[model samples]
Target: MEIKLVKAIPGDVLLLHDVQTRAFQPLLEKYLDYEKNPANEPINRLFEKIQYSSFFKMVVDQKCVGGIRIVARNNSYWISPIFVLPEFQGKGIAQQAICQVEEIFTKHNIWELQTILEEQGNCYLYEKLGYERTDFEQVVNDRMTLVGYRKIKN
Candidate 1:
């Protein structure tokens, strides 16, 4: 399948909102009350992310299938949310999209992100792409575990 990562424009905000809502429903079910999740936020907040972060649309076969939001802080880039629609998963879309994003941020030496502990696919995908699990672990409301990952350019 053809895949492309395009910088999000103002008109794409609502589309991204729908994708996030659809893509993250499973995670929400798994983590229940994942209050910090961008998917759990409102569409207006996504509009804000568009202004403040490097947001992208994952297009596959000429159709928007997923999205990613990365925020740069100091020397590292943080991926707030990288998601692919449930139907288009297992096709390496997220990896391809992330690789495309990495190409644009070559000056950054490190990339970091977090995923819920129970989401094995999300964790494994990052690890397979060379990210290592850092020592940091965050507990949310004493209910769920969030694992942090980091990848340093070598």
Candidate 2:
């Protein structure tokens, strides 16, 4: 399938919000991470992110399947909440999107992200993409923890 990362515009906020909520809903229900779950966030928060961060729609075969948000500072970049719809999971869309975003930001040498530690698939994906797990972690709930990862490009 053809995959592309299209820069998000303000008009795409509702679509982004919808896709994000749908993509993260199962996780939200599983983890009950109301405060930290994108599915639980308001549309306004997504609008703000679109305005402030580099948000891209993960388009596959001309359809918007998911999104990735990047927060950049100098040579470092933070990737938060990259997701694919539940139906679209296990297809490597998220990995392709991440690689495409990194290609778009070629000047950035450091990439950072966080994922649910309990979700081994998520951890495996990031590690497969060359991200090294850091010591930093946030315990979200008794059943969930967020682990930090960083990739330094040389």
Candidate 3:
């Protein structure tokens, strides 16, 4: 469906914020009692960080279907907060964004990549995508847990 990765622009801040809010709403309510607080520090941090990080939004058919945040650290790249709209799920949009990141990582000589998945199904998805789960931690206030995964760049 014509997927492509476009670098984040100043104009995309609000769109990214909307996508982040929509994609995480259910999970936040279920796991963290989060009620879409607009003044959330984490969201603010995401916006501030995006200005200097390798951020990209996945566009499909001229619409922003998904997005990813990749940061360079210690000579490796770590991807986080990859999100695809609920309606767009199961269509390989997340995978395409990740694969694009892998290509960039490899091109730039990045030797490792890591991310955290807070759901079991998502953990399996990461495993299927070649990420090896290293450890998991249970969140004290919720039934959910966090899983960490890493992949050595090829």
Question: Which structure among the candidates has the greatest lDDT?
Answer: 2
TM-score of 1: 0.93
Ordered list by lDDT, greatest first: 2, 1, 3
Q: Which ten residues in a row have the lowest lDDT in candidate 2?
A: 99-108
Whose lDDT is higher: candidate 1's or candidate 2's?
2
Tens digits of per-residue lDDT for model 3, 109-133: 5423333345666766677788776
> Which regions of candidate 1 fall more than 4 Å away from where they truly are?
141-143
Q: What is the C-alpha lDDT profile of model 2 across 65-147, one tens digit per residue?
A: 99999998777999987989898999989999988888888777999998999999999999999999999999998989999
lDDT of 1 by residue, 87-112 (tens): 99999899898788888888888999
Better of 1 and 3 by TM-score: 1
lDDT of each: 0.86, 0.92, 0.69
TM-score to native of every candidate shown: 0.93, 0.97, 0.82
Considering lDDT, which of the candidate structures 1 and 3 is the better prediction for this target? 1
Off by over 4 Å in 3: 33-43, 107-118, 136-140
